[model samples]
Target chain A: MIELQNVAMSYGGGDLFSEISLKLAPGSFHFLTGPSGAGKTTLLKLCYAELMPSAGHVSFMGRDVRTMGRDDIAALRGRIGVVHQDCQFLDHLSVAENVALPLTVARRPLDARELMELLGWVGLKAQADALPPQLSGGERQRAALARAVIMSPDVLLADEPTGNLDWDMSLRLLTLLVELNRMGKTVLIATHDLNLIRAAKQQVSARVLRIANRRLQLAGADL
Target chain B: MRAVLALIRADGRGVDRVVPPTGHTAWLTVLSAAAMAFLAVFALALALATGRLADRWSDALARSATIRISAPVDQMPTQTRAVLEVLATTPGIADYRALDEDEMRALLDPWFGPDLPVETLPLPQLIALTETAEGVDGEGLRLRLAAEAPGAVLDDHTRWRRPLVSAAERLRFLGLISLVLIGGATAGMITLAAQAALAANGQVIRVLRLVGARDSYIARAFVRRFTLRGLSGAALGTVLGMIAVALLPEADAAGGFLTGLGFEGAGWLWPMMIPPMAAAVAFAATRAAALRMLRGIR
Candidate 1:
């Protein structure tokens, strides 16, 4: 439900990317591939209204992101879950508490049973009470995924969701994204991992979009 | 107003999960609030005390004047009688009487003691004049006294009394100004403390924001916390200040201005307002700092 047309991003008096166009439709999965510093993260930021485009328009759902107020942006964000590469968590909070944060911020009631089930789905049920700093990299990635989907968002955006994980961990995390898409959630992931992309294709059909020379293009069966 | 009500209702619900209570800044906020409120109690006491003093001085001096007959010993009685006759015809004067020897001696007791030989000295005769609520015209009274008794001088006490009243009024103004400064300082300190908390918990705030939390939600967590701390600390300070005021030496005729600096009667209720006022200041300061910091994010 996020659309960007002719979007350009600039920083330090120069263009980081320009004339990029993409649309994330319902229940469709897409992978964004780019090398280091090619503005993959910045593109993800634009989709979530974290960064406004230097040119062109970005719309969240049906409304323009530029015209939305602060409260309206917050409400829109609740419908779109995001997973950062760093897997940011309130370290003072336990793993289970961190997973339930989206509902907490939205002022919704916490369902202990649902939280446990989500933790179980992410293979983090055993580490529910552990702190973020205490969790391993793969565990943190899974926990972040659990947090992202806890709200049952209509769209999920993950930036390098498996960047710090091993192949097995990465594939496990990829399967989680596939399961979410199968459940009718639109998913867009930004990464440069070709092997993960090939692994993902074997289980689910996902369009691959590559960012090269400051432009977004649909890559054909390259991996 | 509805937004304020929502913030209030949303205060402690799930705030601890997002912005946990930071210890050092919490202690700083409480201590600063307590100290500022303690100082404010004295400021309030000074204001109330000076207010009462001004009213008392104005009322006691407003409706009265004195006429001093300074004739020679042989002609003093004659001039005194003439002055009395002039006062008798004065329209606004409700009553007039010459002070007897014992009354004059008692008036000078504190300064001259009880051993002064009044009959040996060429002392002046003092006549006390009481006026109606409207009061007598000083110029009219002076002209009448000059015609009837050449040596009589009408002293309305305005020269000395005006300065005293003005000084008390200025003191009251100073006390009020001090209260304002104290409130401003309290707000400044709480704002700094809130900023420090925001900076220290930058990651926490970013995580909360990423999870679809509104700016008001994040701000309410801090605002509610600091407001409660200010209330508790100021409440303690107010009680201690009231106890300290109550223990001051009681006012007496001899104690003069210093003894009257403490609260009297209904004035005791004034210091009780400091706690809630401190809480309000904390609420405003923390909310402003929180919102400003949140705008800088994302």
Candidate 2:
């Protein structure tokens, strides 16, 4: 339920992409692929209103994201779960508290049992009391994902969710996204791992959008 | 512990999760607050003392005037009697008393140490006059005194009273200025503390920003922290200062004037407000710093 129509993005006063467009439908799974410096992260930033388009509109649900107020944008973000590549966490807080941050910032109370179950979904239940610095990269990523989806957001956007993990951990993380997709959440993941995409295809009939020549294309047939 | 509880419950407006990176200045907070409170104690005393001085000066001056009759030793008693008769018929002069030998000796007791032989000495005849608030015509009374008792002179006590009143008023003003400076200094230190905290918490701020936390939410944390510290420190200082002020001597007749340079009854409550006022200053200063830093970030 996120759409980018003729969107152009610039970062630090340099154009990264222009006039590119894609729509993310409900319950759809899409893999965003691109070479290094191809603006994949920039595209996801546009989808979530973290970065506004320099020349065109990025729409979230039915409203134009470019024109929305900050409060409106924050409210919209509560419905879109984002797992950053860096997996930003308050190091002073425990993993469970970190995972529950989105809800806390939204002024919602935490459901302890439900949060533990979500933490367990990505296999991080035992590490709930551990701080971000105390966790491994894979564990941090899983915790980030659990944090992202804590509010039961309609859309899940992950940037390099499996980047720092081994093959087994990558598959385990993918299964969590796949499970979310199966449960009616739209998922768009930015990754360079083709093997992971191939693996994902075996489990879910997902589409692939490849960024090249500063444009987004359906790369499923080529794959 | 009490401060922590107030912060956690924070009136439901929400605690801002932002604090300065460099951390808190617990000692500085306490020190500045204590210092200001101590000085404020003096200021409160000065203001109260000035108020008392103003009342005493006005009271002693308002209804009183003096008459001094000087003449050759042979004519002294006759001139004094004539001056007294003239004063009794004066319109606004409500009452008059002629100071006798023993009364005049008592007046000179402080300076001459009760050693002067007053009865054998040739001293000026002193008449203390009480006037109605409406006041009689001093010029007409002086002319009458000159005609009836040529040596008699009327003194309104104006010349010396102005200087005394002015000196006390100046001390009161200086005390007030000290209080204002103390408050301003407290605010400045708190501002610097807030800025330092902002710099130290840069990473925490970056993380919060990336997570889409608003500037208001982050600033609230710092504002709450600094404000509580300021209030606590100021309160401690105020209590200590008040204790010190209470130990000061009272202004009885035996105490003279220096002992009167402190708070009277009911003037004790004025210094109690400094702590909260200091807290408000801290809250405003930190909130502004946090918001400015937040805006500078993406």
Which candidate gets the maximum TM-score versus the true structure? 1
Best by DockQ: 1
CA deviation > 4 Å runs, candidate 1: B1-13
What interface RMSD does each of the candidate structures achieve?
A: 1.0, 2.8
Candidate 2 lDDT, B1-298, residue by residue in tens: 3443455356633344323234346577667767776777777777778867977896788678889988999999899889888888889988899998899999988888788998887789899999987888999999999999999999988888888878878877887887888888888888888888778778777666555566666777777777877888888888888888777776775667767876666777788778877887787777778888876665
- Model 1 interface CAPRI class: medium
In model 2 chain A, where is the ten-residue run with the lowest total lDDT?
A66-75
Q: State in Å the error of residue A91, model 1.
A: 1.0
What is each predicted model's overall lDDT from 0 to 1?
A: 0.89, 0.83
True-contact fraction for model 1? 0.70
What is candidate 1's lDDT per residue for A1-223, written digit by digit as tens? 8899999999998999999989999999999998999999999999888889999999987789999988888888899899999999998889999999989888899989999999999999999999999999999999999999999999999999988999999999999999999999999999999999999999888999999999999988665
Highest lDDT model number:
1
Model 2 residue pairs with clashes: B16-B220, B16-B221, B20-B197, B20-B198, B21-B197, B21-B200, B21-B201, B22-B200
